[model samples]
Target: MAGLLQRVKSKMAIFAHRKARGMLDGEYGSVFKGRSLDFDDLRGYVPGDEVRDIDWKATARHGSPLIRRYAAVRRQTVLLVTDTGRNMAAEARSGEAKKDIAVLALGVLGYLAHRHGDLVGLVCGDSTATRSLPAKGGEAHLERLLGHVDSHTSLDAAASRIQEQLEYTARTIKGRHLLFVVADEIAADDAMAQLLRRLRAQHEILWLTVRDADLAPYPLTGQVPSAEVDYCSVADSALLPWQPAASAAVKAAYTRATAERDAARRAMLRAAGITEGEVAGSGDVITGLFALLERHRRAG
Candidate 1:
């Protein structure tokens, strides 16, 4: 696990340098503050001003719309809410385990936070149990947290109850935090969307999905060999036998259903005002994460 963490860290080091460049140039918000802004000054409202930034009192006093500007705070908090469900152990098209990709993704963020002298914490769990580490600064502390994530998150665990983790974070974590939710290709059901909305009210939310092979569009032909797949619940598990021969119609229907689910998930995230990115299990996770952060940085 230590070796794996080192490899991830090494791969992410380059991206981290890029992040530093953004900070120095003030092009990308610095890691310490990133998107976190503190009230700085006020100005006349521009045509494109965000409504939320409008100062109603100032507008009334000045007889015109005015907007408040803010400066990025010097320090911030980052919390990683990771899913350790059994499905996360599934292999991706890249033939790498989703859990490893998840770890790498978390590592990149953790390293960045550590470098910026910010607090980094973790909320990791599966269906059975969830563990949390309070936000703290230091490389040693980050290392321990990563080790814990690697040890506790497993593919053999029961189905993931991600809502439990989300609720836990909402209840326990206070103050504004940059929340990174790492999970599988689970559709954002209504309950999950509600939870995310609640979290977004106080925290900046970033969702990173580890893509699953099951959701990948594949060429479906006649007489495809398949195996039994088990779908587990808290109360019980059900194993469905795979069809020995699937018709083109069946394949098309499955693909359509998966696509719809994916689209719905994107919509849910958008509704909750969350930015999201996806990394293939076998792809370069560091690069994917850098891209995600780059987007966030530019937006911020």
Candidate 2:
């Protein structure tokens, strides 16, 4: 089988081709703050490049925009935080497994960290337990990290409880690091919100929410077709297709509840001072991450 890290690189390559060359790399690099003033080199400017980084004299001479690259004062650690449990094995909005989307997102960030000469670590677990891997460099180490996430998550695994991993990091991990989290739709809770706020105080954080599959078919005008609701819930045996008599009123309630949940989740993250981006599937990972990184840079 093709390696997971290889697949991530392939996706990044495609994104680079679709966008400007080195655009994603530039976006990833700029997300961090407080770099050394020591000049390293200059590269052609992309659309997302910071305006302040442009050297006007060099740009005028070269007849194109150029961005100054600085030697970073210190290497940063990017902690890939995620949930590895039955919840992740459930279907995502795009009908792909949520675990697959999580893995893809994690791999992309880890690859960007590796490219930037930053160490990458992982903190993931289900409700039963949490696991941590020390930050390290090199493609081999990244592969091992990705493989661990892939191998552990399954439909039979323990229920997902991202709070466990978050709490583990808070209690054990030391020093400042960039915490990149990817998880599915999570219900709002006061304790989780408070925990997130505390973590934000200690580290730079970015969150990516993998959209969950819809509970019911949209525009339910009654007499919904079986094909419309073919999927079954992973956490339960509830099957929408079996309930052909479900009225439009049912759909309305689901919509309202979903909207309220989303709003609350957003409010919680915003209150914690974290930047969030969402993806529905593997296809959206790169674009979502680009937006996430850009938002983090702007917020910082």
Estimated TM-score for each candidate: 0.78, 0.83
Total colliding residue pairs, candidate 1 = 0
Model 2 scores a TM of: 0.83
Best TM-score goes to which candidate? 2
What digit string (tens of lDDT, one per residue) describes model 1 on residues 1-300?
355457666765555676742342232134334445445788998788667678889989999898888667767788989987777766754657777788888877777777676788999897777789998998778888778877776656777777889999999887788888888777768898898899988888778988766522234333433444433322234543345114467667877887898899989988888888888763556656656666665554
Number of the predicted model whose lDDT against the real structure is largest: 2
**Superposed model 1: Cα runs more than 4 Å off:** 13-65, 69-73, 215-246
lDDT for each residue of candidate 2 in 1-300, tens digit (9 for 90 to 100): 989999998888887777732776788886664564346899999999778788889999999999998776778888999999889998888879999999999999999889888899999999999999999999999999999999999988888899999999999989778899988899889999999999998888999999987664445334455564365656664564645325556667877998999999999999999999999999998888888888887775
